[model samples]
Target: MKSAARHAIDLAGFEAKFRAGPDPWHTLTARDEAIKRQRILRALGDGPIARILELGSGNGSNSQALARRALKLHTCDGSASATQLTRQALADAPNAHAWHIALPAPLPGHRYEAVVIAELLYYLAPRAMQRLAKDVANALAPGARLVLAHHQIEFPDNTQRTAGIHDRFINALGRSVTKVRQFRSQRWIVDGYRA
Candidate 1:
């Protein structure tokens, strides 16, 4: 399959969307999105995560929830506006920090107890995806958790399906990573792994 990075929406496109509206994807009001967030949290469980790195900080809805469960939450997005919104959402939590960055690039340089990549992997090309998988594996501390959530449907801008994205991470992480939790529905898939 071809990489979506070649033709998928670029950083400017994402920034424009965020600039146009606070909740471009209706992340706060969408039923499926709510369900997806719930599933992601459930997969991560109720324990306290010392450090968390979230790859996509969409309007900070998920980030806000994650911040409550983590001692330190670092979240980033390609859109500056999104990052601003994330910061606003997490204003009460001094432990949460948001950065604006173009993804498919290197992740933040820090080993984390947990990492969450949600609704963001399909935008990456195979090479970028592989690189990210490697980065994620390296960033994970021993016994750390990696949680992934992606929509199952194919879209024009997406390079891979949910299953394909999860498989790529599993393959890249090799035998050291093991599945800890999973949830699948017609709309989306959420998988958790332990390193």
Candidate 2:
């Protein structure tokens, strides 16, 4: 099935949502979020990662955890407010950096040992998602890992369901990046791939 054709959320919408309140998604305290975080970390494994890029810095809750495992961590989000929160959350981690980047754009030009994109893809339209998947595939170093997490439930603003989003990425990534792990709950899905 084709992904949804709805327009992706614009920068203003993200800014307003972050400005209205912190933790708008309850990522900091939600039980499911916590579980997803743990699962993502487990998928990344115990080896020290030289560099990690996180595409969606939603309040930086998950970014904080990734920072601990990576020697250098770069995280970006579409909203300035969300990026600020991520910076604050990673303040103590000298190796962590945050940027406000509207996505469906090119990824940072860096070969990373690992990349985490959580709760972000559904916000993008089909073509945007395809572009991002290609960018992500290019950014990953040989033998690098890519971890994706998304909620299973549908939202009115989402341009795709979790499966569609994941499938698009996997297809765009091609045959070289193989799936290494998968975790599914009633509300969420996490998939790990190795390049």
Candidate 3:
């Protein structure tokens, strides 16, 4: 319960800043997100993905856009308000499921062709993040893809602190590793996937 409380605080902090106004970093982050999401989905080739799951949908801009094209989707956040705002913003996409999910659980138990996670992974504690990565890897079906992005620096882990072991452990999995963008100053979105 203590860990859950702390995770909620992290989510709340991001949600609070998002509620403040249209943030430029978020704007820049959105641009990068769009490019990566498109590239990955396209790279998966021409097919409408059946089921979609997202770890942090933020304002739901990405989910709304994806759902319009006819894909079933579920998105969750640690912040209740994030879910509230996402539902409101995504009213147009009736099939997109929005919920609140705490960390280190079974995770969203639905195999997906593609799993999308944006900048939220870095906020997790190292051990918690490990559980998340493994859970996500197991949740994906063969030929499935996991799109992960983070505010990466030259160091490992995140801006909060560098944890190379965790980062390397994630990299060691059977996944493609690459750098995405630097829209938000020094932060880079690193991607991993399974063939």
What would the per-residue lDDT of candidate 3 be over residues 16-107, giving only the tens digit for each residue? 76677534246336766566556545433456777778777766756676565437888887766667767877787877888877655676
**Candidate 1: where are CA atoms >4 Å away?**
1-7, 161-163
How does candidate 2 fare on TM-score? 0.93
| Residue pairs that clash (backbone atoms under 3 angstroms), model 3 | 152-188
List candidate 2 stretches off by more than 4 Å. 1-8
Ranking by TM-score: 2, 1, 3
Per-residue lDDT over 23-98 for candidate 2, one digit per residue giving the tens place of the 0 to 100 score: 9889999998899999999889787899999998978999989999999999999999999999999999999999
Winner on TM-score between 1 and 3 is: 1
By lDDT, the best candidate is 2
Using lDDT as the yardstick, the better of models 2 and 3 is 2
Report every candidate's CA lDDT: 0.85, 0.87, 0.61
Cα deviation of 114 in candidate 2 (Å)?
0.4
